[model samples]
Each structure stands twice: as structure tokens, then as C-alpha cells.
Target: MLATIKNISVTYDGVGKSFSSGDFISGRITLELGKDCKIDYLSIKAKGKSEVRWTERHNNTTVIYHSKDKMFSIEQFIIREQKGQDCNVVAPGTHVYPFTIQIPQQAMPSSFKGAWGKILYTLEAKLSRSMRISSKARAEFPFVSKADLGSIPELMIPQHGTKVKKMKFFTSGKVGMDIHIERMGYYLGEDLNVVVSIENSSSREINKYTLYQKDSFFARGKRRVSTKDILKELGEPIPPSGKLKVTKVLKIHQHIVPSIFTCSNIKCEYRLKIVLDVPYARDPEIKLPLVILPATQTSGLQPPPYLTLGLTRRERKPTRMEQHTTISTAPGAYPPTAPGAYPPTAPGAYPPTAPGAYPPTAPGAFAPPPAYGMYPSLSDFGGKSEWEKR
Candidate 1:
């Protein structure tokens, strides 16, 4: 009978299959058999790896360069050797098996997709049969390791850079460009606001201006770079003395990796580069560093309470005296004191005096304390009188 793998389903912590490093992955494998069959064993495996490869032509010959990093590899057996027989014969309609694995806690690079590079995670289930090829089912998912930008102090401030270059070789005068970014730090899927000013006093005509987001990768000491044009604007030909200003909002893709710092063998970073294309002249370029942050953490300039100093100070608890003092002086804390600094007593109630001292209480002589919710007199607390100090 023919053997076939029906389907495979993977889940992470009762949710979607997507997961991060150090997460527990659980899934089930399903198989269908046409008839009774003999099988050796069943197994499930998971792997996470990254590979970078490219081909270059050298003197009519093609040479390939490749590098690989195995972030993790693990395998577990769903069915092992049978207790009473060399192989197990199954009369199967459908069979299902479950598996669970824990990903390592070490920093795992985010999943990436490129023309010559990929960081991938895969799951496979296989059935072994003697003297024949094994039947297998496979599935692939993405795992992302988020980089936190809240720890970087420099990212909180705005980023600015300016460059001025003099035209050379037949072109005379100077061209200056200024780039200002709202902030150096950003989260994926967030919009980046950029302000650019170009002052041209040169004879060459400006063709266009382009903004590129570059991802630089260092793997096994080999460097690979990829760039995407996030913004482009056609430049109007400026006279010998003219200026142009541009304001743009560029969106960052959510599937990209944040700036990586934990891994030595595999490193990634991003930069914002501006290029001014000029006809018959060398293009002038300016690059500024950018920090991609994880969406799991809040982005943008947070209120001052979350700043570095505030974060550190938040850990300290206020002393008892400070708490009490603050509570005592807080507005609306105590009822307002009555006029003359005396708290009115209850109706027909006379102030207590030393033993053997007669109390004086006459009708229309003392006013009762103001109705509830009204200000109390200072005498309630012994301020010149018991009622006044109350």
C-alpha cells in the first residue's frame, strides 16, 4: 500500500506558530496510509539556520562564495524500536503524533529573506521503511529576536548631518546638503520624518534625490550589503544660485531586523543614505546611522518618566517621612479650618475642661460645626484650643 504524509500543524504556546528565541514550540503530525504497511520508526525534527551565498564571474569562470551559521538543531523521536519486533506493522487509516521543543536562549538573528541570504526555521516529520525512501512532511515558520532600543541613550536625541562638496572638473561653485531626522531610534512599521535642504551654487544641474535604507551584514568575516530606496524625488534643475527643500515621511518595513549587537559572528545594522544625482558630475552622498527597534517595545520619544534617569529613580521607594509629609500637605487633604481658627463643636456640646471646672453651653452662644463636608476649624487639632486643633 502507498504511504503518505497527510499534514503537519505547529503551534507556539497555544497561539500562532511564530515564536522568539527560548520559546517552547509544540505541534502535531498527521499521516494517512492506503493499506497495511510495515515501518521502521517515526521522527520529528526542527532546525534554525542562516546561509549567505553568492556567485561572482571571474575571467569567464564562475566562483561561488558561501557561509552558514546553524542557530539551533534538535530532533525527537515520536516512535522508536518496538518492544517485541524488529519493525512495527501498522493497519492504519490515520496516525497522529505530537512533539515539543525548547529554543535556545542565545541571541538568534531575526529571520531574513534576500536574493543571496536567508535565515530560516523548519519542521519536519518522517516515517522510515526498510528498503524504501522515507515519507516526510515539512513546514516552515519565522522566528524573530527583537532588539530593544530603550537601552541606547543616544537614540533619544534627534539626528542631524550636513555635507558640502565643491564641484570639480569643468563644474564650478559649491553644493551643500543638510539632512535632519526627527530621532535616531525607530520601531519597525513606524514612520520616519526627514527634512532635507539642498543649496546649489554650482553650474551642474541636479537630476534627482534618493533616500536609501541599507542593511549591512557581516557573516563569518565576509560582508554583504543590501539597500532599498525608501524615498525618491525628482529634482528641478536649479539655476547657478538656487535652493530646494524636501520633507518626506518614510515607512520602515516590519519584517526587517533591528540593529544587532549581541552576535559576533553575525552582525546587522541599518543606515539612512541620501544621494544627490547630478548630470555629468559625481553624485554627492551622505549617510547617517539609524537604530531599528523592536515593535514589542514602545517607540517614539516617550514621556520624561521613562527616560534613563527616571527609570533608575523609579526603582527607589519613598521614605515613610516623605510619604507622610507629602500626604499631610496635599491639597484637599484636610477639611478647611473655620474662621477664628476654631473648629465648631457638636450642637449642645461644651468643650471639656479640667476636672471640677464647670462647662458653659448656652443657646445661641456657640455655633455648631459646619455641616459635614465643610471646612473644619484649626482648634480641632489643639491649635490654641482643642476644637481649633481638631
Candidate 2:
């Protein structure tokens, strides 16, 4: 009888099977055997890698350039034979094996699909039989390692540049172009404002102008660049010594990845390229550097709080009367004593001595005062009070 891999099912921790770097992927593999079959071993393997390949035709032969990097690999054996014994022969039934693997966190590139390059993650189950033939089952998935923008503050700042080029080789006439942008950095779903001015002193007529946003990667000692056309405008034929100005807003797409800078072996960058097409003449091109950030970092595009109804906000200031009223209406504004009443002494305490009376002397106790001598005594007033004379 023949042994075969029946099916493979991969399950992740979250709601979907999709995962990111540093995530744990767990799944099960099922095998079916028609009859008793001897097997060398059963193994499951997981791998993540990136590959780039393209072919160029030389004089009569084709030259191919290929580069590949393995990000991670993990393998687990489900069944193995002893040193002196043959492979295990399983009964004709279904067998299930479970596996879990943790993806590496360091230097993990985001998944990509391109015309000549790809980053892929795969899981495979192998059933090694006694014969040369082996039954295998495989599955593929995507992983994303998000590029963070919070650490690089400069990327959020605005950037601008200008370039001037001659209309054709060995030509006296030149075309001066200036490109200005509202910011150097942007997140997905945001709009980028671009201002361009072209001063054409050349004799050739400007036919059209195209703006391209390109993502470039330098990996494995080779450079690969991909571009998406963001904006295009038909140039109004500029006569000799004429000028043209344009202002446009381009929307960033969510499918694009942020600029990558952490990896030494793999470098990713973006540029805004402007091409001015001249009829019957070499096109003049300019490149402006750009930084792409994560969509979550764009606060302006996020939803506002539920309590706010998306209205224009104004700072509210308290009036003088309102300020005074708040303080006056407070619960503990006044002291504990009643109005127009003397301040009370401590609880269960005695009052101070009278104006002309004294207290009995005792250790650490109050002392009695002598007769008045600073001013006229009460006897000098002829037994009448000073107030009566006044």
C-alpha cells in the first residue's frame, strides 16, 4: 500500500491565520495510509526567505543573476527509527501531528511580491517511506514586519529639492525645474502636496510631465527598483524661453511599505521622480528623496473622540465675574470663626488674664502683674475714669 500526506492545517493565535514577525505559528498535519507501510521518518519544516532573479540576454547566451537569503528555518521530527531497528510501519489509518514554531524577530523583512523578487514563508510536512519516493505536503503564507516611524523624527519633516538639466547632450539651452513638497515624510492614506515650476530656455518643446513614486531596495549587492505612477500631466507646449507651473495633490496608497533602514544587508528607500518629456529630445529627470511612515502615525486622519462632534474648536476663557463667583461660592472659603466674633481659643482652654488683673504664680504657670506705672495711675484721675475727662 502507499502512504500519503492527507492534509495540512495551520492555525494562528489571533482571529486570522495571518501573522507578523516574532509570532508563534502552530498547526497540525494529518497523514493517511492505505495499508501497513514502513517509513524512515516524519518531519515538519518551516522557512522564511527572499529571492530575486532575472535573466539578461548576452551576445547569444542568457545570463541569469540570482540572490537569496534565508531569514529563518525550523524543523521538527515526529517519528524516527532507532539505530539498530528499521523504520516504523504504521497501521492503515490516519495519523495527526501538531507543531509550533516561533518566527525570528531580528532582521525579518516584510513580505513582498514583485515582478522579479519575492519574500516567502512556507510550511511543509514530509513522510519518508522505505522506498526512494517520499510523500510531502506544503503550504505558504505571508508575514509582515512593520517599519516604525516613531523612532525617526526627521522623516516627518517636509523636504524639497530642485534640479536643472540641458535639453539634449552638448546643448546650450537648459531647463530649470523646481520641486517643492509640503513634507518630506508621509504615511499611507495621506495626501502629499507637490508644487513644481519648470523654466524652459531650450528650443525643444515640452510634450508632457510625469511624476513617479519609486521604492528601491539594495539587497545582496544588487539594486532593484520599482515605481508607481502617481501623477501625470500633458505639458502645454512651452515656447523657447517659456515657463510652466503645476500644483498637484497625490494620495499615498496603503499597499506600499515604509522606508526600511534598520537592516544592513537590505536597504529600502523611496524617491519622487519627475520626468519632463521633450519632443525629439532626451527627457530631463529629477529625483527627490522621500520617507514613508506607518499609517497609524498619522494623527490627522484618525477618528476624533466620540464626545467631540467634529466641530471647529475654540478655547473657552472664564470672565472676571465668573472667576469671582466660583471662588465665592466655594464651600470652605471663610475661616471657622463667626463674623464679627473674636477668635476662639483651643477646646476646653481658659481665656487670657484681664487688663489690670494677674494670675497666681506657679512652676511653669502664669505670673501676676505689678501696679501700673508707665502712665498716670487710676488714683491720679481723682477716682474718675480717663474717658469721663475726655
Question: How much does candidate 2 score in TM-score?
Answer: 0.56
> For each candidate, C-alpha RMSD in Å?
27.3, 33.9
**What's the TM-score of every candidate structure?**
0.60, 0.56
lDDT of each: 0.54, 0.52
Which candidate number has the best lDDT?
1
Candidate 1, residues 141-195, lDDT tens digits: the string is 6676645555555676777778898888877788998989987678889887778
The residue pairs found clashing in candidate 2 are 158-183, 158-184, 159-184
Error of 1 at 345 (Å): 70
